[model samples]
Target: MLLGSPTVTREAAVWRRRLGGNPFTVAPYALSCRAAFRAHRGSFDARWRRLQQLAPLLSSTAAEEGGSLRFVPEAPTCCQAHVYLRGDAAALDAARDAVLRERGVRVYSRLRGAAVGPEADECYFELTLGPRHLEVADAVYVGAWRAFFAALAGPQPGGRKGVGDAEPQS
Candidate 1:
């Protein structure tokens, strides 16, 4: 199913028509099958292990600040975790911006449109434990995530209401 907004989907369709077809159908020929398999296997294993180790810590950190972690039924096999904060889209965007500007860490705030499913318009951040993250210390990542949530839970400056003032959106 298409996951983007109508405009994005339309643009993609136009581009696809202009390009003759979808470009992702072709597989890269840079690696042999055996080499590709080995590389993917190693990366997958590392990511899985990192996910297992970080999920709980990140969840607990969120919990400490009025946030919670939402995992799908296939969370065990998934490489990403979703953290729901007590706020609206604007609050989430503000927190994300603050975290990036202050901590120099990038955090994603997902806003799924109606096309995705019933969970559309939900305010949450997606965190993934990938191969690149495998090398970083767990404490470092968790600290940044914690700070992000804290920013959401705290009061905003300049007389702006913070995320803590808003009701949690499902």
Candidate 2:
């Protein structure tokens, strides 16, 4: 399902924990996404760096890297766990038929706006779908990210950043 390799699979696990499904299948997709990276970078360290970039993008709800990485701050909708796979993107008619059916998701909505990712394999990039980081994260996820990053980097600014009430953008 993923266009990329194996370790990037953390992406799928985060989703599976949030989405709740057979993580084994999701694990394979994660490997595939990593494999896609292999196709692009032609090396392992570079691809691993790519995964690390994405790792920070996600807010781990549980321990990771042997509890080295803490969960980053997350938005309400983000932590709520929404995931799905649209089997058919070519379908244009009002009633679209799924070429493949995925289980345990409430709805499959089209994600608009170009999301940036390493230009590895193209097809598998679609597997990278996720909701937008919300305004709520300003109150929560950023704090979590800072804490987690600090925990890994040795504490410097521990909860010193003030999250002033910024108007929620629609």
Candidate 3:
């Protein structure tokens, strides 16, 4: 089911039509959802609790970056944490690539709706603490983010100024 404001739902429908047709041929089996939830309720609850605990820590860590990065919602109520990085898009992309290539963790870089525009030199990425993450310590994730921001702030190979070194755009 599509959940959104009327305008958003209408736009989604328009895109759906433009794309040819609805992706799902058959509606999802409701009983399967019920069965899965029942079977994995404990795991789901644990992940939810972990996410709740991690959000504040991640927010505080982002706060320490001195304004280069920030959590979008400030307080997220879901499993995924959305972070907005204010800097050159290319540099942001490089940093994201470096983090995934070097650290073996994936942080998705995609922002929709009002988050993107010609006026802002910023990028939004998502970090999620999934089931595999539950096996690791929280400090690992925090440290990885710190390293990513540092990479964004540090000098590039071709002597390009990092976001922290560049003059702030008006």
- Candidate 1, residues 58-167, lDDT tens digits: the string is 66777776774554422446666554444567767777777777778876646442223235544555666656777888777777777677677677556533444564
Question: If ranked by TM-score, best first, what sequence of candidates would result?
Answer: 3, 1, 2
Model 3 lDDT tens row, 27-119 = 356557777768766676567668777777766776685435565566656666666667666766666666776687544554432336333
Model 2 lDDT-worst window of ten: 92-101
Model 3 CA lDDT for position 87: 69
Flag the better candidate by lDDT, 1 or 2. 1
**All models: lDDT?**
0.64, 0.33, 0.65
After superposition, the stretches of candidate 3 with alpha carbons farther than 4 Å from their true spots are 2-24, 27-41, 109-119, 156-170
TM-score between model 3 and native: 0.61
**Clash counts for all predictions:** 0, 15, 0
Query: How many backbone clashes are present in model 2?
Result: 15
The CA-based lDDT of model 3 is what? Answer: 0.65
